[model samples]
Target: MSYRNTGTLFTVLVFLFATAGARAWAGSQSKLVAFTVDSVLAADTNKGIDVRIASMGARLRKVFSYTTYRLISRQRRRTQCGRMTGFDLPGGRILHVEPRTVVGDTIGMELVLFQGPRPVMTTELRLKRHAVLMIGGPHYEQGMLIIAITVDTPGSHDVLVHEPRIHQHQRLHAVSTPGQAP
Candidate 1:
């Protein structure tokens, strides 16, 4: 090959290598996840609301019609895409959350709510960046339980709480497997 052609080939190879590295970095970037588990109690009267979950009280009333909702626990974790992170929930249940990918401003995640060794609920979902996925009802206390999971971009403010943004999520990309993506 001519020297000129060799130089061109080297330049093209360099560009391709850089592009592949960038894509890998983007896929493996750390995701900041915020999860809140609330213990909700219902009553016959429209009397009480917990100040901690006051933001969610109205929504709870609208969806659940329960008299009260309290924030039992609020925790946040940072994990890479496809890595599993476990959260300790009320009633000794374990929640395993795995963040998969980001498409535009939306995030893809998988959740498994386990009681002891058996898996109770497992779902794969995607939601907008600012939205929170609330999984409610599983018998926690007198009433039930609500688990809210949020994954947002770094440097963003705390996500707001709304009436359980549990819309049908479309899978943007095929997952490798649980705990198996880079």
Candidate 2:
């Protein structure tokens, strides 16, 4: 083959090899976000030690592409996994609040409370984490609602809690699984 033709062929082969290697390396890169739950129970003070007594329910509407909802009844065996036991909701909607899996580093959730057709209230929450997030919630009373979330991380993490800038009650706290101090 002519020298020019041979040189052109070598350049094309080199470019192909470089492109393939780059793609293989990118595939091995760690996922941008991941999640996990603690096998051991959190400390009594860190857990939902019945600090408050209340009942709340919501109908799950598929806004995001992926979400899992489980109904949990207080009467059932209350344990770590049993957190999502059982109850009931109108229109056959799931009632229990269980651990959820949200892909990507940022998770967005919206909940609305309806009393027969008329909308009573709505809530919007955002979660951003590098690891997994163990969440439990939908607790409510009168017009007050609370969502408890436990984040899972093998390393010490700084969680950012965002509320209105004008609100003084906005704050962030950390706790760990039972036995371990945060």
Top model number, TM-score: 1
lDDT (C-alpha, whole model) for all candidates: 0.67, 0.32
lDDT of candidate 1 over 1-182, digit per residue (tens): 99999999999999999999998777556555444444444443455777876766665555554655666787777676777888888888888888787666677888899988789999998878766567765665555577766667565554443545544444456445322111
On residues 145-172, what C-alpha lDDT tens digit does candidate 2 reach at each position? 2222322212225443322122233225
Q: Clashing residue pairs in candidate 2, if any?
A: 35-132, 42-178, 71-86, 71-96, 72-85, 72-86, 72-96, 73-86
- The C-alpha local distance difference test score for the whole of candidate 1 amounts to 0.67
The true-versus-predicted C-alpha distance at residue 172 of model 2, in Å, is 11
